[model samples]
Target chain A: MHNSSRRGFMGKAFGAVAGVGAVGSLVAMKKTWDPLPSVKAAGFTTLDMSIYPEGKLITEKWRGKPIFILRKTKEMIDSQTESQATRDIVVAGIHYMIAIGLCTHLGCIPAYIPAEKEFHCACHGGQFDWSGQVTKTPPPRGLDIPPFKIEGNKMILGEVGPEFQAMKDSGVTL
Target chain B: MAHFTKATSVKDWLNQRLAVEKIEKVMASEYWIPKNINFLWAMGMILAITFALLLVSGIFLLMYYNPDVNLAFDSVNYTIMREVDFGWLWRHVHGVAASVVFLVIYIHMFTGIYYGSYKKGREMIWLSGMLLFVTFSAEAFSGYMLPWGQMSYWAGMVITNIFSLGGLHMDGLVEWIRGDYVPAQAFLTRFFMLHVFLLPLAIMGLIGLHFAALRIPHVNNQDGEEIDFDAEAKKYLDGDKAGSKVMRFANDFMSKDMMVVGIYLIFFFYLVFYNYGFAMDPVNFDPANGLKTPTHIYPEWYFLWSYEILRPFSINIGLMAFGFAQVIFMLLPWLDRSPNAVPASRRGKFKIWFWLLLVDMIVLTAMGKLPPQGIFSTIGLVAALGFIALWIALPFITMNEKKV
Candidate 1:
């Protein structure tokens, strides 16, 4: 009985030690991202699609901008080609055309309005319709799609939002 | 005449004030303090003393501090590190002491809950304590932003974003609070003023009121025994054995409290001189640019449980749940019960509840730092549910306990 009791006690202690060790390791490993170093990297690289293939998306950092290079999906290209008002749409989701993922009024990410077939400002209520036309007046002009060239299976896109001339003529870069 | 000509010894000077005969007489006199104090009984004075320390040191800070956002960080650094005599020491003391004050306040309130200090005559004290904690937490949060560090900036954004739940346009409110679109110079300045002046003043006044109300009922002693005596004395018309006499404040309470104070001072100095105030994450040291969102935004440790609660649920539920937890705590006196409000008699039940609370708190804290969607969050949800169950069980268990 004494021996059994000793074994029991030892078993419990071992279990506790194991439990603690497991928890410590789990917590240590669970740190998904390191904030300190990223914050310290005073400058970040910005990527432009000019380097990649058509339909390929690459990430580059000019400062902190998240630039993407997506070769137009066949459906997306077809949808934009079909709509005159949205002919300037750079990319299209199944339900809505994205003029530029960037907002026309203020350079914020706009949400696709699937039901309205428009691009809506997630920040403010600025809206653009299927043709990339500014449906809302606060936006001075239609949204501008950054110029991109498709070469074979790859696509190259500029890092800047749009041509200065196009932005001025449209007066939409507000 | 010959003796008078000689210089007085150190002993002679002390002898007159601390005459053994007088000291002996005072020590022998049977003084009545409430005999029924439970563990919860000790925390009230501790908290009060802490609040007083915070107030005095904060006032000293205000004298050297400038409230302008642009100038606030540098000014604080200068005041603590360079400008004033022992300014570094005192500022570090005050900064560290603030963290300690909050830590003590949390423990004190927990003691109150576990021991049922919220019951009977102690209800007002408990309420006042809760109110003090809420105010103190708010002050700490706003003051944190005054440093204009990376953590402060992001912490401000994260907390302010809570107001934007489900299409609520709180931009106006945010701008009003921030004094700009994002946390900017105006907000920092205003927060500095509030932290150094307005909040501390309000806390001091409240502390005074809380203590005054407590004095009227004498410190509640351990167990229900002392409290029962209070009622019996009141009933029998025995003059004030029930805890109405005022002892010499300096000699009786101060001596004991001083020991605690000394120990605390040592610890406080260590943290200030060695650790400095806990550094905000280095990334937050960058200027607050609204364009960049920090990858992870978490509140200070004290607020983690509530923040964790907000993370797992839908926005609407999370918002409601956030306020709900605080409201539940504020209304705790009515929510929980222990027979006659003394812990000794209710130990078995209170112990269970205390352990349950500890578990819940730890689990919630762990959850708060995790991403909202995952197995970890699921575990967090289970723990939260367990917490709710335990909270609801306190009254039921206490009310049904057999008389000792």
Candidate 2:
């Protein structure tokens, strides 16, 4: 190859190498973007709902996240369970929800925006309706419905409820 | 066109519907940049490169960062620094690139001012750039709070309290924003969202408008001479050719921009690795303590000049002046009444006042570091007045000057 062509080829080669290397290194260095796992394992974790009463939300680290265990108000439950969209997550009669707190988009937990009647992700503007369906996306789907059970008005969460399971077997899908 | 419409390929099918080829040619390939433009034109592209770096590194930092007040400091400074793979690299790069972005923006803004790039039909470009700077500050301020450090906490407090100067209570709004009566989890989390998502999106839209406005008139050279594109284009095939006056954006200007960007990355990395302290304040090493304020609270260095202008006078009057001065500066396009597109070298008072205002800004920046006492206070007061006076006097000076 002539000197000029060889130099041009070498320049292009170096540029391409440097460009790919820079981006590759940056991405390789990034930690996994998954939301921190909830530490409270998927089993029967007992919580007395009496103390939490209606309208209080309690948080526990299940699977390494502070997944919300809400003693939801009767009104909130009435409104939510009335719709089929929330059937999988809402407790059968007790007005409780073991809802996933972490945003599906970037894993940052969202705070309940009271005025908006929705959970708004702080890290990104992903909004979930009261029924947990994503009203605004960038979160591809709604907040995850963590499976739970209620016994004697006390919540046994992160496990399938026997009564709920029987109902599901009868083809009653929420 | 047939190649893009082939039935077997999704990429081709979508590209065909989107008209991707035509868009690329119109936006990039066929766009013409002024050929003789110097290195300073590279400032806009450098600002762009630095912003890209900030976005990438910031995303990586966000992966491991927790925005809870009790955990934010430890999560950012300890666990992310010590546990996460290449956490230190991402953290340092993001922090350093923030300062670099501001530096590039300042240079770009002042370069336009010096060359009168904002004059005439490019008013919208200047306005968008000004608004971009405002959004940039909001973006930076919100990010600063994410670490929950001493300066971040105190600065947030001071700036929020500045709203009280109008005498109406601001505590309610402040508490509403913080999600608490104090800087806490809510504040950190909300700021993280704004910094990472909202501001980035807003600034990109503004930059798109800036670029759109820029392409209309093309870039202004050092002389800031008007180009009658109809006359210039008639010299060659209007659609296909770029003359000596205007270079093609695809290869000629893009190659040069890439070369400058490569060189700038070397310096950027040097600061990220070796002189990283310039990007951070020593006070930020301590976690935020609301019970105690730092002895001397100051803004980041990029804001020092404007902060200095607001300092050393009666709090009420100085604050008013600061707001007024910013508005005046942004309105420079209409305010500067010079008939000449290219300013004359020896335009008497106008030329002298231009350099004078530049010197005043440097002096004010220096004063921002000193205690507002003795000579510095007097200098600050004078600098504030003189800076405003220069702008107020510019139109009169321009009208009196002899045309080149």
Candidate 3:
């Protein structure tokens, strides 16, 4: 064969070899890629919000339920306080308000609407007021408030403060 | 109009209309590479291998991987790692390759920046790279969620939560992105969808375009000189020249690319086999429990610098600044009013400024890892300011540069 023909043959031969190699590696790789195991959401911890920064609602998990570590403004706190007798969701915040972020109607997480200052569930259109009061229907009850305590800068979730002890001792339910 | 048969060669079939043999000769066999590129140019070859490595490893991991919020960690840490044969190998390869991809890309990026690869007619190529960079971040971020580990869970929630920085009611938007109120099965599913399909496709498309752009513009050389292909070719075709002035793509550059890829694999495999979890977060081994937050939350090392740089400002400002920093790089060519397309190394002041920016990034990354208190924030603000200053100063510094 001439020099040009020899070079053409060589190039074709190289391409063929490379193609085969690619196929072989892909086949080998398939063994590893064949298993389609599900990726579950992992455990997570939000960074400690020392003093639960104002106008912030950080989500935490408590017993598979999302717990919102919400810092209420002074006005919001007063509004809840004025209506405290009719409706209360336990643990009156000296500061941050903590509530299980699940809808009371069905067990679905509700998105917090900052403009409306309410949590609205997408599943059933369940809405709760800023203070966890049931504002809209489908949700039979208000948002379930979690047992939490004010400990320095952090709002300790799923744990009660000394207020719980004092209230329990005094036989306070509301 | 002859129909191709089973035995007909691809070259023969393609050559009928495509002139496959001739085009290959011209583009690959006969096309010339610039001879002056240093070892830094080898990074392009290494990066190509990194993509394949990640794809194969990722596919394997995905096959064994479960995306359910409840079962993600167990399947990855236990089922895939302990139960499946060679599962651990693929997992490690995938894990290590993620970091390796970023490492090479970082080197490639700085190399490009320093070489002024984005200058002049090459703006679109650089822009495509910037798009690739963005897609890589998205792909990596989505991949981070698949394991359903602590880091995956929290990182998913935290990063998506950043979208709330806009003035609009982003709560609904965040929920839509998360597919739930917070990071949950819905969020995991969306991330899986992107990581498995959408973003990968985008990356593949971008890569194709990136290569096309590179080929069309020809590789930028150190001297910022353009190769007059036809002139050189005519001279070489004539007896006037002993050989072609430019390096042949197939015999010269491709061979070096292949050799460099082989060398890169040695290092890549070493890291994969010995330190599989080197790039992964150890905290990610534990299943996600939303109640107990980690002591200190941090982003991946690649993003740690920006995370720190954007740390001081409120969510809105910090978020904006972080985004602007990456987008700024994409706009670098336009931001640079200087007529010079010369390599950044040649521009003495610009080189110093770039190093200062690198130093600033180093400091910010350290801050991102540390507790944002005491001196850290002070240092972070200074570094952040310095970094921003360097980027913003690009046009001013290069204004007087001679247009090559």
Candidate 4:
């Protein structure tokens, strides 16, 4: 009886050690899947806000995703609801609508119509107003705003500032 | 027989060490199969041949294909198509087989369902087959991304985004899955690894398991009748073969299976030579652009039925329905509470239920290809809701069935 108990105890101890080694190996392997340092270093993109004309939408690539930058006209700024105005990013005393170009429905790029002042996703017929708020069915939410900070007339994407943090706190952007 | 008479012969010596004769008898020559089954029983052999074709063609394509994001498109379209000898033929064969294999799987699955093959003793066979289906789907999806075309990039984006739980804002998980904010070099290399090495290894192991699971229960037949296999085998051995209801799996059933496979290969190569364009989407011919998306983005036809279910509803509910559609087939052994293991045509209400489910899936597939507008939207909504309704009613509708 005593010998059998000793064998059981030794088997359990060996199993416990092997289990810990396996878990450690898995953790090491999983760490290799993260983005490389060079990729992380290329994350932030800075665009001069003054170069884009008012009411004209321009697409810039930030970390391989399309970022839409549209300097709002006076009429576009005036037409926003009180809720929509809170989502707008104001840079150097000028209101601008900046959002990731991929639609929330299925990640297709939404095209901006200059005359209608709205972005339409042709893949599923989802629409977003000038402030990037959803105005159609299908798309569960509006266009997502990228993390950014404003400095003078330059806007840097992928760096969280207080304004972006406020939007995050209010659940306006993710 | 003559070789076994000599003890020093290689066949006799190896048989003594390996018990080769015993294994051959147990697995093939003495293994019994019902005599009533038809050509549908040959699908398992057909699928194995198609998988072999895919592996050979994929290896030929991999010789010159590059996995880099910057060069992958041209490497496939220019280098492989124009430079390598008979490269287009291999691509055409691989493309058609990938699409045609799913059609054969659906026919195989519905055959199992119609004849009540997932009854008491055969649950593991059904489960392993379903596992193979899911793995093949993952294989096809990963292989689609290797060309790095317009549809490949956008489809990768849409599918990876599903990891972001609808309202929970799990964008971190989505980005982690992609290894970036979007599909790029890292995403391309990871999918390439999955397509070439990891997934194919898993598929080969699962195919072994699928065959192993079939060993004890044996294959079901068209009538779902229970035959006394041992008695029939004994009768045939006693020189009453004309009256026996079973045949040996080796020479008898295998000959029938080979006949079906011959006809199937002729049809398969016809598609590979002439109708291969139907398998390669026109939109995917263009290079990937992060700034642009095709006007109508849709998955390949095999997935369209379930993809349509995700549309026409609110986001969370749509995702829930889609999740249910993917997994409900795995639960068929449990959800069906009928006492009889007979064919669906003789099971009263199950006949109507079976036909309706097939028709609804066809309607969903048709609507999934069209733009969701006007009449298509209404038909899609009704079919999607009807699909959920039918599954919910399954257990109750089947519980009171009279045993045949």
Top-lDDT candidate index: 4
| RMSD of model 4 against the true structure | 2.3
Per-residue accuracy of model 2 over B57-130 as CA lDDT, tens digit each:
98899898988888888998898899998999999999899878888888898777777788778888899999
In angstroms, the error of model 4 at B225 is: 0.5
- Per-model TM values vs. the true structure: 0.62, 0.66, 0.71, 0.97
lDDT (CA) per prediction: 0.58, 0.71, 0.72, 0.89
Among the numbered candidates, top TM-score falls to: 4
**Model 3 regions more than 4 Å off:** A1-174, B1-14, B166-169, B236-243, B402-404
TM-score per model (chain B): 0.78, 0.92, 0.93, 0.97
Q: In model 4 chain A, where is the ten-residue run with the lowest total lDDT?
A: A28-37
- Candidate 2 local lDDT, A1-174, one digit each (tens): 699999999999999999999998877534222111221133336666566556555666543335666666666755654443334344435555556675554344667765666777533246676656677644555665555577776766556777567645654322
lDDT (10s digit) by residue, model 3, range B1-404: 76655636766777876788898877786676777777788887788888888898778887778888778888898989999999988888888888788888889988888788887689888999989999999999999889988788777766776675533426555655665556777678778998999999999999998988887677888787777877775665565444656667777788888887888899889988886666878888778766544545677888888787666654455667887786788888887777767777777777787688777878888888876665876787788888788888988887776654
- The Cα RMSD in angstroms, rounded to one decimal, for candidate 2 relative to the true structure is 18.9
Q: What is the DockQ for all candidates, taken in turn?
A: 0.02, 0.01, 0.05, 0.68
Q: Of 1 and 4, which scores higher on lDDT?
A: 4
Query: Who is ahead in lDDT, 2 or 3?
Result: 3
After the best TM-score superposition of candidate 1, give how far the Cα of residue B355 lies from its true spot, in angstroms: 1.9
The 10 consecutive residues of candidate 1 chain A with the worst lDDT sum are A89-98
Q: Is candidate 2 or candidate 3 better by TM-score?
A: 3
